[model samples]
Target: MSEPIRVCVTGAAGQIAYSLLYMIANGDVFGREQKVILTLLDIEPMMGVLEGVVMELSDCAFTLLTQVIPTADPAVAFKDVSVAFLVGAMPRRQGMERKDLLSANVKIFKVQGEALNTYAKKDVKVLVVGNPANTNALICSHYAPTIPKENFTAMTRLDQNRARAQIAQRVGTDISNVQNIIIWGNHSATQFPDVANGTANGKAITDLVDTSYLQSEFIETVQKRGAAVIAARKMSSAMSAAKAAADHVRDWWLGTTGTFVSMGVLSDGSYNIPKDIVFSFPVEIQNKQWKIVQGLNIDEFARGKLDITTKELLEEKEEAMAICNAN
Candidate 1:
């Protein structure tokens, strides 16, 4: 049998993790033949809840399951883990300002980052799934100096999946028909879900759908889809977010087969995006590494949209810098 892959998940008792844990155990992220040992973490108060989660995982009788460890200590949870999902963060509550939210989460990520630096495998692949994920990832990366910055990514696959589904619906086709859709910038309202360079059933998306709707309604819908889910479901998106998180790590671990997927990775000055900012861009994964898809022409409209999102990320970095750098 192959050696077991150590996978760590934070916020193990939360909604997204509730949906995500089973998928990971079932070999949805790692391959079916791969054995996995999960190290799950949460706050001390949530440790009992995490224990219940472990009990459920035990009941599943997954053939590839090796073991499950539940703990409140980040160091213990992260130790020797090859893949770490930094899925826990402070959620935005009613009446909480943006700065307050940033401040709260920055501290959480800072501690986790330090623990990861001290404990996780040198090549650990970390994906931040929590809200304001791009900035949270930035803060985490800033503290984990031992881990390669490129190994740290934020989840933009959710946004990309939403964009792909929207285009597929507009074109009256399955989502499998849409290819190369890009979710650029932060995973916020300013995110640019571009379909201009994408295709639906081997034809350019712009040729298949109304350009006006693509630019306006389609963009708005994808940006606000999370809020819409919250309003209708009385909670934030759990299943889709969980699935997206799985897909994000799966594609990064396996290769993307020369396809473009959206990932919020540290900027290397590509498209003039500032270096070290965790920004989403069109990328192709190969050899377990991501390279930004280069030389794609950005029209004036796209440029304007990118600028707005970039400005927001920059402001977020500045707002959280004091907290992020304190470690």
Candidate 2:
């Protein structure tokens, strides 16, 4: 058996972490054979709550959970960690502009990024799960010069999963039958959930569903699913978000076999997306690395959609960069 690995999760007392910890502890993420030592971090006010969480973890009797360390200090939380889930960020409140929330999280992620650079393992993989996640991840990557740009990613798998489910439902097929559904650009409402190249049971999704609905209703539903969930549940998605995060890391560790999944990684000018900003694209996992799927025929309709979402990401990048420069 391989040695137990340390996994650090920020916002340990929050709803997402509440669901996330158990998944990792039960080997839902690291597989049944690999053991893990969980390093949990939150602010001082949340530490008491975090301790309760630790107690619950201890009570679970998970054979794969070798240790659970709760701390308020970033340095302590991050020390020698292999996989760091930067899941903690300030949520946007009523009457607040998106830029206002971005500024607050910029400072928080900058500090955490510095901590990761100072204390984490050389090849630590960072996944930003908080709101404004793509920008927060870009800020974190900017601050941590030592960590490779490719190692920093934001969670768009949630959007991808939602898109896949929506497509499957529209076509009256099993969810597993939908493949290669792409979520391009940001995690917000502007995101384009494209099924142009997707398949349902080895057939093109466009052939299965009406083109008009695919362009209009399907796109809107997948993009706004989070808000719809909050409207119905009075709370944001937690369990599904946790599951997507786990699947993302799992696919990155294992391989995706040329299957298309969405990940927001710092772009290298692929698909006409500018560099230094993290953007979601149709990607395949191989050799423990993700590469953008190339040579897709983007028709005029897809181009127009990509332009809108790309513009939003560019504006968000400017806001995050302005905050970083000012600080």
What stretches of model 1 exceed 4 Å from their correct place? Answer: none
Clashes of 2: 0
- Candidate 2 regions exceeding 4 Å error are none
User: Per-residue lDDT of 1-327 in model 1, one digit per residue for the tens?
Assistant: 689999999999999999999899999988888899999999999988888898999999999889999999998999999999988999999999999999999889989999999999989999999989999999998889999999999999999999999888888899998999999999898999998899999999989888889889999999999999999999999999999999999999988985799999999999989887899999998889889999999999999999999999999999899765663
The candidate maximizing lDDT is: 1
Q: Which residue pairs come into collision in candidate 1?
A: none
TM-score of 1: 0.98
Clashes of each: 0, 0
lDDT of 1: 0.93
Model 2 lDDT vs. the true structure? Answer: 0.90
TM-score of 2: 0.98
